[model samples]
Target: MEYSEKKALAIKEYFAGGTTSTKLGLKYGFGNASVSRWVAMEKKKKRKFEEYAASIRAVREGMPTDVKALQEELRMARLNISLLEAMIDISDDQHGTDIRKKAGTRRS
Candidate 1:
């Protein structure tokens, strides 16, 4: 019934993913506008925790060194990069008709 308890419950409901924040807030008696703030705060908390974990892992591991392991990691990284680039190209092709047209004009 307390405000913090209501906010905590709203946050949990929002992160569970299927439920909209408005529905969660209404169910939990929080104002609709506060739902967006609550979701943003939850995202920031998650991001901070992830960054902290990565820093801790980096300090503990001191980085990888084996040549084979390094090569495999590099290969995976390149594959991921290529996949991301392809996705960007597809997005640009789908949504950038004006920009593409201008670039084609300049090339002529």
Candidate 2:
């Protein structure tokens, strides 16, 4: 059964008119199952659209969206860098390792 926008609009109109799918299907020449399927599809589309709109609104409000994960990752990176620098300093001082890069020419 090929459904189109026309049939969908008719379903919406019949629904808005306070009629049941059983009656609307009879009037629209489709079975109740078809009408229900069309309504369900429309509902799913509406939910997805609403979610997308909400995300857009969040961004417009300067509320960083989808950044919590990035923030967590950045925080971990900083911690790791700190730990590595501490290890390097401890190794250079206690172990007498000359791995640290020199900043400039040493004066005689």
Candidate 3:
């Protein structure tokens, strides 16, 4: 059975929040494999997972936006990240313990 894109996306969003496919399948009345496939397909459709996830987040928040709007929002976010990283760098210099986690470091 074919599901609507909206339904597939809703399932994908829930799955992203650490929900297992088997549980989601039982809740949504579909097979576990189907839930997995739907989530995988949604992820596979976009090249950049982070940006795709951001767009999905925006949509879920009830704000329908065009590509231009998304682009502008992304730009603003990048600027905010730059500002935050600068602040973190400054704070780290003034502190004893490392504040920022190194890339690929396992959480202890």
Predicted model with the maximum lDDT: 1
Task: Tell me each candidate's TM-score.
Answer: 0.54, 0.51, 0.35
Give the per-residue lDDT digits (tens) of candidate 1, residues 1-108: 898888888888788789887788789887777987978988999999999999999866765546668899999999999998788778888987433244435544
User: Tens-digit lDDT track for model 3 on 1-108?
Assistant: 456754675576665697787887787677889887877776766647878899999797765557668989999999999999989888888885588778999968
The global Cα lDDT (0 to 1) of model 3 is 0.76
For model 2, residues 6-107, the per-residue Cα lDDT tens digits are 587656876587887778788768788888888777778989999999999878776454577689899999999999999999988998997766899587
Q: Compute the lDDT of residue 15 as modeled in candidate 3.
A: 53
Best by TM-score: 1
Residue-level error in angstroms, candidate 3, position 9: 5.8
RMSD of each predicted structure = 21.3, 8.1, 21.4
- Model 2 TM: 0.51
**lDDT agreement with native, every candidate:** 0.82, 0.80, 0.76
Q: Please give the RMSD of candidate 2 to the true structure.
A: 8.1
Let me know the TM-score candidate 1 reaches against the reference structure.
0.54
Clashes of each: 0, 0, 0
